[model samples]
Target: MSLNVLAVDDSRTMRDMLNLALSSAGFTAHLAEDGLHGLEVLSEIEPDVIITDINMPRMDGFGFIEALRSDDRWSRIPILVLTTESADELKAKARSAGATGWIVKPFDPAKLVKALQMVAG
Candidate 1:
């Protein structure tokens, strides 16, 4: 089955890159500017997985994950944080907020695809 993905990031370039990677790997990709936008997009699409950046203007990844986890309708969806930060504390925070996995920024296209498939499966 072709998995549907929601990619949330403030960076237009990052969103574009994610779109290219996900589409090339045979997944349908949806884009959102930030956490709030991600939530809005989430309501419209039943994404198999979600990929979000850590740092953002409106709402950060931690807030997004927390918000998503609070809702039973989307709590079980796999969320993978894509960011430049590799700090342990941030990862712990994300985990506590309900993230399924994490990927450092400048992500490898192949690895990103693999990570999504592994979690979404």
Candidate 2:
């Protein structure tokens, strides 16, 4: 089955790039502008994996993960955090909030595909 993925970021460019990259890597991708929008999109599309940015308007990545984890239906969904923040503290926070893994920003498409494969597999 084709993997369904949700790419959540405040930047339109980032969302578009992720969508293109994931689609090229054989996954169907859905784009969301921010955490709040991501939640709304998730309600409509049951994605196999979620890739999100840390900083966003309305709601951030942490809020997104917390919300997801609180929901029984979405708690076990694999989450791959894609962010520019490389601080260990932030990584720990993400882990505590239930992110499955993380990928630093400016990540290569191939590396992202590998990470996604590892998480979604």
Models 1 onward score TM values of 0.98, 0.97
The whole-model lDDT of each prediction reads: 0.95, 0.93
Number of the predicted model whose TM-score against the real structure is largest: 1
Off by over 4 Å in 2: none
Instruction: For residues 53-103, write the lDDT of model 2, one tens digit per residue.
Output: 999999999999999999998999999999999999999999999999999
lDDT, model 2, position 85: 96
Pairing residues by index, what is the TM-score of model 1?
A: 0.98
How well is each residue in 1-121 modelled by candidate 1, as lDDT tens digits? Answer: 5899999999999999999999999999999999999999998999999999989988999999999999999999999999999999999999999999999989999999999999999
Error of 2 at 22 (Å): 0.6
Q: Which ten residues in a row have the lowest lDDT in candidate 2?
A: 112-121
Give the TM-score (vs. native) of candidate 2.
0.97
Task: In model 2, state the lDDT of residue 43.
Answer: 87
Instruction: Give the per-residue Cα lDDT of candidate 1 at 82.
Output: 99
